[model samples]
Target: MSGQLFVIGLGPGNASQVTPEASHAVAEAEFFFGYGPYVDRLELRPDQTRIASDNREELSRANAALQRAAEGAKVAVVSGGDPGVFAMAAAVCEAIEKGPVEWRDIDLTIIPGVTAMLAVAARIGAPLGHDFCTISLSDNLKPWAVIERRLEAAASAGFVIALYNPISKARPWQLGSAFEILRRHLPGDTPVIFGRAAGRPDERIEIVKLEQADPAKADMATCVMIGSPETSIVERAHKPPLVYTPRFSTESSQ
Candidate 1:
């Protein structure tokens, strides 16, 4: 009998945020494969085996899961947040595309979860109520030039931007460079949010103006969100401030 491969998204870090389908998929799998930290989060059954690897070994991890499925082991390749959103789903699909014809016979399912951007938006307000785009500031897989172009284009288009993989020890300067590009098109007082480790114990949400959004406040665990021109803030007495983009567009009103 042919075995199955489930690419599951663990959501942020909170177990409650995970979808029922994704949880079921994790429970059903006989073998789990993922980056070590993500794999460590799962509540594995006694009958299950885990294949954990370093964060950068996505392709190899996907391949190993595929190999296990081909050998009749039900496998789950897990990712943090939504697997399809800058995670293992794409890597698994790419592996299947490049593998042998027999690889096509494996049952593959992509289980979605609450992506970090959306979770962060929910915790703050609906900053993404209007048009928006997501970008990864990491240049590990793509060139910095390509990332720069996308950042400039997004800023020019006035799209509320959600930045993933914003900064790390090796890529410390990219977030600063991206902010500089945004400053060229956006006002200095525009709203920006630094949502770090959302849903985790150390989770923090910092709201600041673009001028105050220092890249030093971010790390690999942070998701930086920049508001579009249409975005606005509403303050309440004894309540945290709310930031949101208006649903209606001025273009339609004209």
Candidate 2:
């Protein structure tokens, strides 16, 4: 019999953010496969085998997990955030669809966790209270033109935008390029949030205007949230400002 495969999201690299269901899934696994950092984060049992790979090997990692599961090994494939969001879940799905026919019968479960954008949003207030869209700024998978078109479309649609994989060593200028496109459709003073290492010890949150967003401050660990025109910021005397996008486009009468 084929063993089960669980694609678990280890939310924002914090113990508290991981769901109990995800914990249980981990406990049940005899083998774990994931990016090296995420694999290192787990408290592995003595009997569990750890399959760690460097970044950008998502497809290979997913195949490894699936093959082991097919061999009757209870396996867990870990992703940094909710696996469905630009993580292992999609890769696993695609692999199953394209791989050997028997792979389809293998039991699979995806355990969700707190995605980075949601964790960052909570820390900054309710910037995602209304309609929102997420986009990855990495051009490694798709063409830069596609990203620009999506940015323009999201800006024109006035959706709260949460950007993932905003900047990295190899693609440092994408964030700045994104801001340039967005500013054409969004106001110069629109609220932009930079949440770095959101739930970890070195977490940092910065609020800035669209025109003032410095791409230099961003890295791969950061998630950038850009508020819609209706988004509001509330200042407090002794606390960080609260940023939120309202549920309604305009005020409603009582």
Candidate 1, poorest ten consecutive residues by summed lDDT: 245-254
lDDT of 1 by residue, 127-215 (tens): 99999999999898999999999999999888999999999998789999999999999998889999988998999999999988899
Q: CA lDDT of each candidate?
A: 0.92, 0.93
In candidate 2, residue 43 scores what lDDT? 96
TM-scores for all predictions: 0.98, 0.97
TM-score of 1: 0.98
Candidate 2, poorest ten consecutive residues by summed lDDT: 245-254
lDDT of 2: 0.93
In candidate 2, position 121 carries an lDDT of: 96
Provide the lDDT at 70 for model 2: 94
Off by over 4 Å in 2: 251-254
The pairs that clash in candidate 2 are none
